[model samples]
Target: MNERMIRLADQSGRCDLHTHTQASDGMQPPAENVRLAREKGLAALAITDHDTVAGIAEALEAGKQYGITVVPGVEISTRAGGKDIHVLGYYVDPQHGLFLSRLAELRATRAQRNEAIILKLRNLGIDITLEKVVAGIGRELKPDESIGRPHIADELVRLGAAADMRDAFDKYLADGAAAFVLPPRITPEEACQWIIGAGGAPVLAHPGLYGDDELVRGIVERSAFRGIEVYHSDHGPAEEARYLAMAAEYGLVVTGGSDFHGARQGVIFHGDIGSVTVSVDVLGQLKS
Candidate 1:
């Protein structure tokens, strides 16, 4: 552990267990995310980019330079009850062969979905292509980066088909829209198992936002999750209280984060980095 990080943690009790970077749909790069967390006085941060661990090495390297603890993490997309579920894995081995193979399969499926969405948009007389979307984003999709609806929405905005990301989604890219395409995903149980196999702790991400308490309960009962994200930028006091009670009842670790994706999508909630404060105890629990 870095001594400076220890001092910062003692002073602020700041630990953000969730965040994103350009390894996926986030606007900033992994190093920039680390720098931002350091500037904001965060003692620890996790780069839980969607479906990819490509950013972890960079984040860990940056963390060493910044004297902040960077937890290697990934947020996986899973399917449950016809709704999307996200499972966060912490302290994962990015180079684990099984995890890498599974992620590659998911990314391939994501590419297929992106192409299908583009075809659907074209069929609707809205001309767009995967290349255009990549170009609009100003970066080629990295090998491990999973193309998502946000990239499609950005292309739509560039093409003048929609005013902005929300407009693009409302017009043709969101679920039930003309250009919508469901990508392949593992189940919640499989996601938890994968994380365990990769030597990580699996946590339920943003259960309050799912709006299905029974479903959340069912996952907790059926899966091997070790933690619950009790504090998030989107969770209100009531929601946080309820999750806290649930965590205690289940003897699960409690985690929190800002889920910051940068300024492109605007303010997510409380503010940005340092928005949702987490206890360093949570990090210790996750590591153990």
Candidate 2:
């Protein structure tokens, strides 16, 4: 963070514990995210990109240059009870061999899902393809980089099939939508195992988005979770209150974040960086 920006930040040193980068589906490069976090006067920001840690190295370097603490993190996509569950892992060893291998497998599954979505779109006369979406990305995806529904949504917007990413999800890519695909994947329990296996702190990310408190509670109550995202850009006061009480009930670390994924077609995915945050003291609890 810039000196003035950092100085202007909340006196308590606020941290946004969730975010994405181009290494995943986010539009910004890892360095750019750090720079923005600095400009926004955040004490720290986590690079919790989906299924990969490719962004962490760059973010860490940027963190050093900008004097910001960049938490190495990943958001693992899992399935349970017919729902998509996301588990956020913090302070992971980005170069862990088994972790990398497992993430590669998940990326392959994601690629397959992307292909299936493309096929479904084609069948519906949408005329979009995986090749086109990759080409539209303007650069080749690295081994650890990922492509998800957001990329497909961008292509749909380009093809005029949808006005924006939100519309694309509403009409086709979201769960239960026309092109939605729910392949059998690991459960949240397994995801917790994966995170803990990598010596990272696993946090249940944005529980309110799941819509089923029972399923959310199941993971929180049963998994080896270190924290709960009690504060999120998408969460209302009631949702925040519910999760805060749950965190207290379970003795879990209380965390918060903006879940920033950068702007897509002039719309920010979840939130802007620093829009929702918690005191940086939680970083210590997470590390412990």
Candidate 3:
């Protein structure tokens, strides 16, 4: 660890277990995100970009220069009870073919979904185009890699439809928003199995937000995942307490994270890695 990192750890500081970069739905690139993490004095971080490990290599390389350890991770969007749920996978082999194949399929689905969203928005008189979105993305993405809402949000900002990405999500992109379109998704149990099969620990990203403790528990009991996120920026104090207690009672590891997605998600960006205050020891426990 760097001196700044050690100091942050000594201060009862933060460690963000979840984040994204331009390689996924986030606005900032991985290298810039690492610089922000170092500036924020975060000790450890993970780049849990949606359904892909494309950002991990960049994050790991950047972390090395800044004295932070980057967890190889992904945030997979899956379904349960007709609602989308996010599963966080950490310390996985990026080359795991099972994980890679599933992600590839998801990315293809995401592309189809994005195209459909664009068509829907056009029909709704949004005056936006997919070409505009691709242009705003400003990077050459591989054919199989996913370009998501953030790219569209960027296009919206560029087109003067929204002041910023958050505005775009609020007015158009987020669930229930005007441009919202639900994509095909796998069940949470299936997602957890994929993560476990890839030799990673699968943790429920934010169970408190799911609002179905009984159902969530049912899935948890059936899956091989060993943990739940008990602390998060979007979670209330009461919710965190409840999740922590539930995790303890269920013999599940309790984790925390900031869920930072740069400016794309509206909240202020904390460190890309250290916004949750998770101890290194807690991260170590996941290895077992």
Candidate 4:
């Protein structure tokens, strides 16, 4: 009966639990993401920017102005099985010193990866420099913000080194690409511990993307994750069904989101703000 009531209430509103903003690699500012959610009629949004909570303050302020709830979140990058993995933390205390310190450490790894990619591009005669990459961004990145591959990709295209972001990634930045690098980093278990320590709920993000159910299963089994992203822009019906079952088997809550990063030259990254969402009631579940 309780679950049925929750479902009935969810029909009235929804939340997008995954998104990015310029505080990380996204093109839009934090407040703009909130405004977009308002326009989309979403009851809530989460600013799960990469490795930084710097965007959360502005997003939280916008939530009040725009009449939407912003979930304080971060997408921590991790590595396992020779692949990149991301863990999303919701309701984390943005001011937690240890969490900030740990995120800074992760950002440092990202810097190393970026420099390695730049070196590889230079070796390939692309001639893009880290300084040039920062210059092309039109503004100085925040102290907590580090250069991401997408920014590098944009600089490459701006320099006519690549046709587009996709081209830039396919040839240089994506996994298995010539310039790709996966430096050593914390495990997903450690990330989960970070989130838990910061009084946040950790959720496994985009399980299907891993291409290794065993890895996903191991993380779910080993970590203190409270939820799984059963619905995502990249997930198909089959993938969703599989993860939905996985969530049920693990007694985990299901969260879904568009993973919005705004459009670039008429191309939206994963999807638009409301392209995929879950019942707004799920927000309460995450908080609990």
The lDDT of each candidate is: 0.85, 0.89, 0.79, 0.88
lDDT of 1 by residue, 151-215 (tens): 78877877889987778889898778878888877999999999999999999999998999899
List residue ranges in candidate 4 displaced over 4 A: 1-12
> Which tens-of-lDDT digit does each residue in 30-147 have in candidate 4?
9999999898778899999999998999999999999999999999988877778899999999999999999998888888888888899999988789999999878988887777
Candidate 2 Cα errors over 4 Å, as ranges: 1-12
TM-score of candidate 2 against the unseen true structure = 0.95
TM-score of each: 0.92, 0.95, 0.88, 0.95
Clashes of 4: 0
Rank ordering of all candidates by lDDT, starting from the highest:
2, 4, 1, 3
Can you write out model 3's per-residue Cα lDDT over 52-126, one digit (the tens) per residue? 898888888999999887888888998887567889998888989878999999998998999988988888787
Q: Pick the candidate with the highest lDDT.
A: 2
Model 2 agreement with the true structure over 1-288: per-residue lDDT tens digits: 732244235634888899999999998999999999899888799999999999999999999999899999999999876789999999999989999999999999999999999999999999898889998888998878988889999999999999988899999999899999987688788888888889899999999999999988887877899999988889887898899899999999988888899998888979898888888889999999
Models, CA RMSD each: 4.1, 3.4, 3.9, 3.0
**Consecutive 10-residue window with the lowest summed lDDT within model 3:** 3-12
Of 1 and 4, the candidate ahead on lDDT is: 4
> Total clashing residue pairs per candidate?
0, 1, 7, 0
